[model samples]
Target chain A: MISKKLAATAVLALSALLAAGCGSTKDAARPAAGGAGAEAGRAGVVLPLLTSPFWQAYNNYVPRMAKELGVETLPTVNSNSDPAQQVTDINNLVTQGVKGIVVSPLDSAAIVAGLRQAENKGIPVVAVDVAPESGKVFMIVRANNRAYGEKACKHIGDQVKKGKVVQIQGDLASVNGRERSEAFNQCMKANYPDIKVLEIPAEWKSDVAAAKLDGLLNANPDVKGIYLQAGGVYLAPTLQTLKSKGMLRPAGDDKHIVIVSNDGIPQEFDAIRKGEIDATVSQPADAYARYGLFYVKAAMEGKTFRPGPTDHDSEIVKLPNGLLEDQLAAPLVTKENVDDKALWGNSVK
Target chain B: MRRLRELALVPALVALIVLGAFVNENFLSYANIISILGSSAALAMVVLAESLILITGKIDLSLESVVGIAPALGALVVIPAASAGFGLELPTAVGLALIVVVGALVGAFNGFLVVKLRLNAFIVSLAMLIVLRGLLVGATKGKTLFDMPEPFFALATTTFLGIPISVWLAAAAFGVAGFFLRYHRLGRALYAIGGNPAAARAAGIRVDRVLLGVFVVAGALSGLGGLIQTGYVGAINANQGANMIFMVMAAAVVGGIAMDGGRGTMSGALTGVLLLGVVTNLLTLAQVSSFWIQSIQGAIILVALMIARVTTGRAQE
Candidate 1:
């Protein structure tokens, strides 16, 4: 009788185990089916700085474009502008099983390990706006900043005739800053050799630029031309200071101080029109987002992608030949073209 | 004589106003003054929040992180699809509520370490600061959140009755905070704890609970400040609260809040904020370099602290 009872209890336990297994399978399948039916793929995007208007515009556009593409983009932004956070976000995205990732890295070099970590997990990363220093990402989509710099420099060089040019550089350590400064300096040296370049690091801060400019102005009162790599907000105080010091008006009938800036923010545009600023290179806000999404889509689909050589280290990556080069078609806006409402309206004062 | 020492900030404030007015007619202009008040409002709220924690003889070095995370969470909530996922569409009010709740939760966590675990407030808050900063950086992926609805942006730039909405909100916050600090039983308990923790505990006051409550209140106020700051800038970035801790602490100290705690009035904190704002405005008008502005601000804070210390010492003698 005891042997019979033991056999009966074992049979009952086996049936219970099978039922429990079936129940769990159903539970898991239900969510999987539901998730598939939602028609949305999860993508993670990492940006360098959230507070900047450039990044802000980029963040706003990515999600909107992702929605249109029927993908849900989860943007994980770092407030401290730290690369470690970028690595952590990538790892987290990988663990969460995201379909793809788009990152605007703070330090391109520091994020290589993180990108490798993601790649190890079979997750594809799309470097957006800012390319990573090492590793082959699925794709890199960024504006041709060097070309933009060259164009900006050429425009300023064309306007100025034999004057000391002061270049207000962004953060020297930043990839964007370094590339822009290099391109601008190279173009100035090649095309306008007479224009002496006095490069000062502004650290991409308005206040810092203003202070540095003050010292620069004090030292180089005869400096007549200024090329700023960033937006025009920081240049306002400097210009105001110059105006106060009676250095704004040219000795002759000319715009005395030729101020050229990048990032055609609304205030900059307005200043250009008012003759407070000379010109600004228009960096369309929508372009940052649209390009980011395109790269992300290509990455997720395993399609080969590459940005402009000026924007990325293409030769280092040994990209396949015949890839369409990405270029920033940034139109130079001066007082003459400042009234172009279609493009200029997006500028934030 | 003690009352005079408490009122010492008023004469200095008046003198600053007179000096500023004499220096530049634009200083008294409606637009410039409004701008000053608008900018100060956010910092003032931060100071007020810190003041609450200060009164309880504890410091929250994590305030900057609290400021960053709360607004970020608010942004996450207001994202239309976030509501659908969570099955709740948080309106601005609801979003703000969520921010405060999360802030309170973080504050409670800090309080748990300090009050329950018996850790040093400074060290605990500092750790919390780093953790929250990391979380903010991780959550946002180093990007900023913008494109807030027009109504939300209006909260930052809109003017109500010749005053910016932010300034009005700050005033309301200060009034309420001042009333609570002056009259509420819990407020009194906080002061008592700051004055003498052991004596207060012996007198049947739940010292731990009061300290925790102070942190929670401070966190809630900080959450509100974050919302205001995000609105004011029309964007929420990862560095939203970077370098703000120093300003808040300086304002509190300059306002005559004792470092050892158990002292200071809300009005004094406001005075301190106003003084900083005025100095900044003057420098801007003077077209001073940004580098000099920072140095000058540091100097002003030092001078104010020195003056307060001297006055307090004289009063004691």
Candidate 2:
């Protein structure tokens, strides 16, 4: 018992020392005055995780854009999609005294503490991709998730005009999940009346999605199409399940299910161009990168923008509460247009 | 524990069934029962493994990671070199062999730490859990591997006697484990060592060897569970079995497994697995809000724990 206590105490002491070392190093890293692009100041970005390509794009993009903008970017810290870790990271960034913070919350409601901490600290925050359910943000720069859902619905609807369609949901606690699911169901009912949509809530985990998809496929062998809310997690598993069941092919192969998915990941792009699957709604990486940092800089620089169709060459929408939102339009990328140099998929590899 | 306390689980199961039927008329149908049984296979395996370890007065927190890394290593070997894979492309037989080896190796590592080094089983296994999970993420690069051979999924996709083979795997694991626990010398030694290791050792029982073997069997069962989960999902994901430790432990505890050790029945653990599974499916079929599912699960575990503690005449909490 004494030895075990000593071991635990030693580990705790080591951790405290390491944390203190990190704090001192960050404090010592305030660069000299009048450096080029130094006016942009040092900033911190807290992302969810790098598990999916969609998140990896944002994680890789922010640092690159910060370098171009002449701002000193601290090493991007991810919560690994844990809400508690997100709160800790945000608190650490605040302690580090970053001029601005760009955050993509893992959960809308669970992120209130971190956002409130930033608000208390007077650090400008830009919410990327996902908006916080509570707490104030200087601005939100994201794609229109509802718009992406509608496009997926139309793509699958056009291909399979009268059959069962499976819609695999992401984490429904987030704004993206609710919007995409509701929009798709509504669109299918309004336009493709013959299509019967079966909803399976997979909660952003590939294994969960795969198991549910496998079961659904077993029960309904003739299911015509599948709409994956996010491809970064769902794409590989959905493809694998289909392949095991001998259902993967080109547009008119022996058994082909019209696969319309979200998140234009690099692998999905490869799959699309290879004719293994249909189109994917490409959420703009530029929106996550340049636009996210743009809002942080604007908020820190005391620039105020309002809700409108377009604001200073950027698309803007007036939110219900008169809050301004910079929403980018997503495109349906297929094999025909997979070569677009500007697409995030081409940029990844 | 009394047989009456054990028999009490039947009412809980029936209550879930009754509630499920009231919520959705199709819940009692043949198709939904099959779905429930199929989904419970992996969980049942996990609970069975936990029952062994818990009965031995030890806990293996790394069982969940064992489930993930075991199958990942199995699939990684067969992945063709053309797609940034390891390129071994071993035969299906060799791939399955790799999974058992990895599982045994992990179990041996845990046993060495706990028995040989006399470390706390809980802490050692917890660290092993983190390390193995990290290794999985690094090995797979957080990418799901679907390029595994066709036979890898046969355990889940195939049927015998008109039911999924996966369900039979769970049943067989429990049946063999129960019989072994009741009749085998080494298995009986597990109870004696967990109840009092020093006394068991004085009684000429090889306590450490028996305990180590128990962990090994637990690990292999967990590894098999991982394989079953991979087959059921029809894909191998890096994040497989993440956060599964809590569920396994909860089932064991609810089934009247004493956390302190040396007291739990295979049937009780099995009942816990079934009860939890039915409640979850019932909630999902009832269309309860997604956000409340976690809370509801916690509430069910708490309720079951209280009932078990009251019936067993011990303050488990």
Candidate 3:
């Protein structure tokens, strides 16, 4: 019999381990300047781990942008993609009395309390990359995940006029995951009536993605394209699986899967270079540095911010909380423009 | 009743295949069957490892962490430092050996705490699970490792008579383990110890030693599984084994291994992994709504349990 005690322990252990990784590294907060003008208040910059080149570019740019904006950045903390721990770190920031915070939360819903705490305390917060569920955040500046999905779908639609396509969706719990899944499916349905969509929730796990993709490829050998939501995690396995099946080929090959992936990470760039995959949605790291910091500084200065035409190519819209959100430009990165120096992957070095 | 319970998994397997065939014409395809077996390879080892421990009145929650950390340690040394890795570039042979050593050391550490220190095995392993996970994140700095030599995936990539070598490795592990549990005296003592530790000790079965041995074996299995998993995934992320314990525990318990102690089979555990795999494959094949897939998986497990109980004429536990 499974003991009640064992069950309880199992649950507690899962919660604790799952909760541990988001990072509770409490950096001493910097105080805001007393006077206004360019002397904006000090802010906390919490980004995800810089292990991947995507975040490395952010790690490179955000603080530099903060300095140019005259905001003193606290030593950055890496959330490492655990949502709950991010809450702890943000709460720590709140307690440190930082005048403002710019956080790239791992999950949207899981960071509500952390954002709400900053809101309740009247500290301006700029949620970078992910928007919280219900928080009094001043602004959200993120890559439009829906647009990324649409671009991926359009890329696939361009490659294959009518055929089966697999959407290798990311983790479903996050806002990125949900939006990408919905918009890609919606785009495919609207644009390509003859294209059948098969959904595989690989959850950013390479093996799961590889295995599910293998099964689907085998079941439908003539499948024309694959839209992988997270390229950094999926590219390696996707290539390996395709190569093993003798299906990995450059675009324009008679029999090749027109693979379009999201997140312009270095791995995706390499795949694009090799022509093993067709394209990727480049979510520029500078968008976070520029817009994410701008709104935080504006909110701190007691000023209402509005998006401009030249500001990271973002369009302004009302967030759920009635605050204006700017959905930043996410460009489709193809092998043709893989060497674009303006892209984050090219700029990381 | 127990014998019937052990055999009940066979009909469940057949029924799932039949149901899958009815639902999807591609169900019986060579690719689909190979997909099921391929997916089951590494998981089967973890299931057998957990089964051996549970039957010996213990659990190793860190087995999953072992699966994550051992390969991570290997990768840390082999990958370049500029890429946020150590860049030691240890030879493939050394990396492979290190995987075994990491697993053995971690297992021995867990065994020492539970057996010698007389600490609660559950709590200790739970803590080790967290510590090892942390160590992995620290070691890799949350980077995903993928540049290992081709030999790293030899077991997964190569095939013997059109089946992956991973399937063969898993089979050999199951064969040896199943034979040992069914015939060997040392293996017999494991059940005796788990069934009644005090009685087993009085009867000179060396309960503590057998329990420690089970943990070591479980750890080594986890290491082998780690190699196979690394090969299968083709890359290792920092979060590799994050929620793997849930699957391992679920597989063993669902396969008729009593969570408390003292009963299970290789066939039962293999069936458990395959059933889970098949159900997963079915959901994708049937194009079941994504959100409903998890609920459907849970439902199938419950249905499988009810069938087992009905066939055995008693509650599974």
Top candidate when judged by DockQ against the true structure:
3
* Candidate with best TM-score: 3
**TM-score for each prediction?**
0.58, 0.81, 0.92
Using Cα atoms, each model's DockQ against the true complex is 0.09, 0.19, 0.38
lDDT of 3 by residue, A1-349 (tens): 4698899999999999988855533332333445566556578888866555567678888778887877777888887766787888888887787888989888777778887667666678888888777767778888889999899988999779798998888888778999999999999899999999998888778778877777777778888898988887888778877776778878778997899988888778888888888899988788778778788777778777665444445687887567667888888998789999888877664
In model 3, the Cα lDDT at residue A91 comes to 83
lDDT of 2 by residue, A137-201 (tens): 88888888889899999999998999889898988767899899989989999999999987668
Question: Candidate 2 at B142: error in angstroms?
Answer: 3.3
Better of 2 and 3 by DockQ: 3
lDDT of 3 by residue, B1-317 (tens): 65677676667778888999998889889978887788778888888888999998888899999999998887777767765558787787888888878888898899999999999999999999999988997787667787787777777788999998989999999899888988999978878887889999999998878888888888888888888888877888777777888888877877888888878877788778888888878777887887777788799888887787777776667
Q: Which pairs clash in model 3?
A: none
**lDDT ranking, best first:** 3, 2, 1
**In what order do the candidates fall by DockQ, top score first?**
3, 2, 1
Q: lDDT tens digits, residues B151-174, model 1?
A: 544555567886768789999989
TM-score of candidate 2's A chain against the true A chain: 0.85
User: What tens-digit string does per-residue lDDT give for candidate 1 at A1-349?
Assistant: 9999999999999999987777421232111112323433577877776655566566667777777766677765552477888788787787686777878778868888888776666666777667676775776666667877897788778878577888877776777888888999899989998888776665664434543454455445677788888773345445544653457663234647887888776666667767777888887666656666766666565556433243422321333532233454567888778888756335332
